[model samples]
Target: MNDPIVKVEKLSHRYSVQWAIRDIDFEITKNGIYGLLGSNGAGKSTTMNIMCGVLKQTAGNVFIRGINIRDNPVEAKRHIGFLPQKPPLHVDLTVEEYLRYCARLRHIPKQEIEKAITDVMGRCAITHFRKRLIRNLSGGYQQRVGIAQAIIHNPEFVVLDEPTNGLDPNQILEIRKLVKEIAEERTIILSTHILSEVQATCDHIRMIEQGRVVFAGTVDEFDNYIIPNTLIVTMISMPPADELRSIPGIAGVEELGGPKYRLKFTDGQDVKERIIETSVARGWRLTEIFAEKSSLDAIFAELSKK
Candidate 1:
């Protein structure tokens, strides 16, 4: 039976004196697209490699459907298919030959190999390019082949590292579509530092900062959870940071100098209106007040910025 659950408990990794990832824990239940988000070198790849058994973590463990990766590597690995940032492809092999070879490598039964190849090709939208040599295809087509290879074994969990790292905008869109289509039946772990791509395609997010998880939550929850207290206030006159802190819903204020101020407020209060009304009653001249919308890009920068 295919079970699509992955759990990482107290996951940690180090390189000599440098710590790459530390004390990260999260769980994936059921099937959906998950994005592991962080800035470059924040350890997204390190964690993914540990999960795939490519690099051994100095401590902690990963579980695939309750099977510990260290305890039962073969059985645990059989349930996972991984595509690293740079895909391994043979330049001379046609798309058809390449997929057939991948099937053999995964030890797919000879009798079912043809059906597996055809299905993965169709899912990746590479059936039209089946006869073209891998080297001859565009980056977009090559990426499709990489994805097809990962799924050809029909693994329950597919891990893709920076699947759209170098493609043009149109190619990125196509890959996102293919990722969504693939996630319908199996779980996927998408590791990337790019925010726009994750915002457009991921269902859940695990935000890694300096090799540790700063946040783990659903996409919707993350936006609301992180942004409820963030706002921008542009005014001709501003109150003292201490006075502004006393306003309902207003938890903290940072003076950006000149005409700009950043405000942090909790939900459940009309923070903007209260600020405006209070300013008017005090005869403080105002110009503009705006709430900064939460975007994956901005949120990631805030969490990972030094």
Candidate 2:
């Protein structure tokens, strides 16, 4: 098995009298997108900052490609590209100029600087804006420029904090596609509060709360953690709640709206056929009746309880 491209163990960070993050741990394998999910002020940024060597951790260690960041900061950093919550952009420079500068800063060979800039710009789909001043571009285009700088070095690992924070639906889709394409060869760690973003883009998810990882696994694992034996059933025809409750295997039911209900069931039972039979016996007009797995939003809410 290939070693993890990024490993963070027992990581902790403090701010004067406060602990921003505590004992966080996770790993990222090559060529996969890992989602870091948490609410605001949940230490998502602090953890990302520490991983990129932008902020010092009060305790613990971060390793990139088997190199300890604390012992060899420069070498460790050379293998990482980080985009913070607010992307750092030089508004005065055009996209091409800024990227060329980044390539130089990343120490790409002088002879390869131009080619690196051109390649990354094209990879991020910002080639059209190469000659445009960054300040003059739309937020989406500016974001693409940020991405271009992050990947210009062809780092083995990329850490992006809220990459799709402020974009319309179309722009969000475009950036998501860009991140997916980039993950083909490099490890991408994405941190976001947007549950849909994880569901749409991540192969695995790690959910943190109060500076500690509460859950870490694939999307299916996260969903199962919160909703082990649950199903949502919606019907266009209104049925009496009490009568619906009489079904044998149903453990509980909650009315969601005028004609919707969320049903919980005991383990080792399939309730769909029973629900159908009940509807038929009562002569109820059942427009729709199907079981649904809980969504990521539901899972997050369930996991973040007091």
User: What would the C-alpha RMSD of candidate 1 be, to one decimal place?
Assistant: 4.8
Clashes of each: 0, 0
TM per prediction:
0.81, 0.87
Give candidate 2 misplaced runs (Cα > 4 Å). Answer: 228-243, 251-263, 267-289
Q: What local distance difference test score does each model get?
A: 0.88, 0.86
Cα lDDT for residue 79, candidate 1: 86
In candidate 1, what are the lDDT values of residues 24-43, reduced to their tens digit? 99888889999998888899
Model 2, global lDDT: 0.86
The best candidate by lDDT is 1
